[model samples]
Target: MQVEMQDIHKAFGKNQVLTGVHFELLPGEIHALMGENGAGKSTLMNILTGLHQADRGTILINGKERSFSSPKEAEQNGMAFIHQELNVWPGMTVLENLFLGRELKNGFGFLKMKEMKALAKEQFERLDVDIPLEQEAGLCSVGQQQMIEIAKALMVNAEVIIMDEPTAALTDREIAKLFEVIDTLRKQGVSIVYISHRMEEIFTICDRITVMRDGQTVDTTKIADTTFDEVVKKMVGRELKDRFPARAASLGEVALEVRNFTRKGAFENISFSVRAGEIVGVSGLMGAGRTEIMRAIFGLDRMDSGELYRNGKKIKVHSPGEAVKHGIGLITEDRKDEGLILDFSIRHNIALPNVEGLSSKGFIDGKEEQQFVEDLIKRLTIKTESAETSAGNLSGGNQQKVVLAKWIGTNPDVLILDEPTRGVDVGAKREIYALMNELTDRGVAIVMVSSELPEVLGMSDRVIVIHEGKLSGELSREEATQEKIMTLATGGE
Candidate 1:
């Protein structure tokens, strides 16, 4: 199997996402598609997968020009796209989801349940995954669900699979399992288009790499022939002088303090504090309750027992609205799912949090709302043609900006960001870091939950490590190394 995209150009209204980008994948080889967020990677993939039509481009499969009108046609042509967001019927069993669209039936039109289960088992064995056929997909762990998504693609007999950030939600052990599965697929003569931000994964599993930047193809080279620094330079079109912006200038008064926070099985005895003008990083492995603690503090989750104090004033956060009323805001993870309303335009999404203020006598003041959104668009440097554009039309990086913009509109004294830079490009990451620096300098305390160790150490004034939902240890910026954080994360004192 082979795919070649030539002179690809796509645009959404005035936004030119991909321009004259060329990409190719050889048979049985894992090819990496590398780019900064909104650098046209998703656009190119959408064009190939028939989710969107390329205004100008040619798609060739095995030296034959082909035209696909829809995603189903693309899959029928042996091209499958496994999205970063797992596409599974969480309410259904694993066997049911595998044969969802193309269920086998007998001559009498009876469902072939046993046959489907057997096929599901075969596919799972191929990936070396152990999942109960009767178990609901929603009950499975994120990693297991991802494995099911891959197996779903295989069930369609897809030879050319495009995996978009497949390992983003997986733990270390799950990542190893996914890599083993990818190796097996490559050996089985499946051509894979691997898209991920993690450079280490590229070097480990990818045979060839193609980089796209600013809607253009920078270069494609063998994995052995390039360095991580070189790849990043091409992706961002600049040498990254500093991965993280400098830490806060100095700590001010305590902005937010959580003491003896407990949430049943989610987290236990999670106590922490963030000073005004300080960035406190929360670091831990997956399922270490990093996100849970933040959710509880921000009123997204109910705490079994805890005391929350803002500026030495005890406050009750029973709901997100209450949190916002108290000058607290949260930029949640899964930006596309939780942070923004995709159906709404950028103007409306940003205005949602501030409706109370953007309204007049119980009715929303249209002019006031529009002006507020316009101000934020410019202030945040969000890349949208106009505030009227649907947020779904924007890129990952731009969408994240909207989430931040929406939260900042509330005028928060304490802000919590969970995996703030996840799934965004390097260029966008630098800007977000700079924004954090600016916010902290203005006396907004920030608590950042990050899986990236470098980000945890480089950006935070203090590092808080969590092990199995309990506070393991705390480290000053001077004392926080990868070794030290990992030791604490793995339950070391």
Candidate 2:
């Protein structure tokens, strides 16, 4: 199997996202695509997977020129794409989702359930993923859901597989398992197109690397022949000074405190404290209530019993409006669903929480709103044509910046970020981390909930682990480690 894309050019209206991009992949090789945010990586992949048509290009599969009218056409031609966003149906079970639109039928034309379950189970085993075929897909963790998506592609025996940021939300162990599976597939003559921002993973797993910058292919090289610094230079066209900024503030008195926080099945007795200018991180497995804890604190969900204190003063919050009024802002994990209104313009989204700040006598002051949004966009360094651009049209990294800008407009004293950098490219991830440090230096406390161990260990001033709806353990920044956190998270302590 071989895929050769020649001089691919794509444009949306006046935005020339992809320009003469050329790449090739061979059988039994894992090829990694590297680029910064809005570097035309997604556009090129979309063209290859048949999600969008290129304005001018040639796609040759196995030495034959071909046209893919739809995703089904590409799939029929042994091509599969697992998008960065999971597209599984929550209402359907694992087995049903695996065989949807192509179910096996008996001679009587009835649906064949037994055969589907058996096949689904076999596929799960082949990937070494533990999931119940009869269980609803929604009930599973995000990592398990991702595994199911990969298994679906494998069930069709795709010769070419494109995985976009597959390990963004996976733990170290889960990532190891996924890499093992990819290696196995490669040995079976599968050609994989891997897209990720994790430099180490690309060097470890990919056989060949292609660098794309500003919608053009910069260079292609073998993993063994390149270094991380070289790849970063090619991706950004410059040297990156420090991924994480220096923390300059000394910790102050406790700024936010939670006592006996309980939400029944979600999380319980989650007592923690964040001092002024301190960054506290909550690390746990998916479904272990990391995000739920953040939501509960931000008043998105009702708590059965809890006490919240801000600056040594007890406060009661029952709604997000109250949370904002009390100087609490939450950046949700699902940015597309809960953070931003896709249909709204960037100015409208940024000024949502702080609309009152831009109003005079019950009427919105357009000039004031525009000035505030412009300042925020500049402060956050959000890449956008203008503030009037729709939030949905921005890339994943830019959309995340909009979410941050929206919350920061509220001038919250404590900010809670749930999976803050998930699905973002490496350059964007570095920018976000630097922003967090800057916020902390300005005396704003931050609480981060992340599934990535390295992120939690690297950024947090203190670490807390939750297991089975309870606070498993808490460790200071100096004491927290991968092994220690994993042990506490898995209930070993």
TM per model? 0.93, 0.95
- Deviation in Å, model 1, residue 126 alpha carbon: 5.5
For candidate 2, the 10 contiguous residues with the lowest summed lDDT are: 241-250
* Cand. 1 Cα-lDDT: 0.88
Question: On residues 295-331, what C-alpha lDDT tens digit does candidate 2 reach at each position?
Answer: 8888998899999999999999999999998899999
- Which candidate number would show the highest TM-score if scored against the true structure? 2
249, model 2: CA deviation in Å?
A: 2.9
What would the TM-score be for candidate 2 when compared with the true structure?
Answer: 0.95
- Candidate 1 deviant stretches above 4 angstroms: 104-108, 118-144, 363-365
lDDT of candidate 2 at residue 314, scale 0 to 100: 99
Q: lDDT for every model?
A: 0.88, 0.89
RMSD of each: 2.3, 1.8
Candidate 1 residue lDDT tens string, 3-102: 8999999977777888899999999999999998778887788889899999998999899998789989999989999987678788999888888889
**Model 2 segments beyond 4 Å from truth?**
none
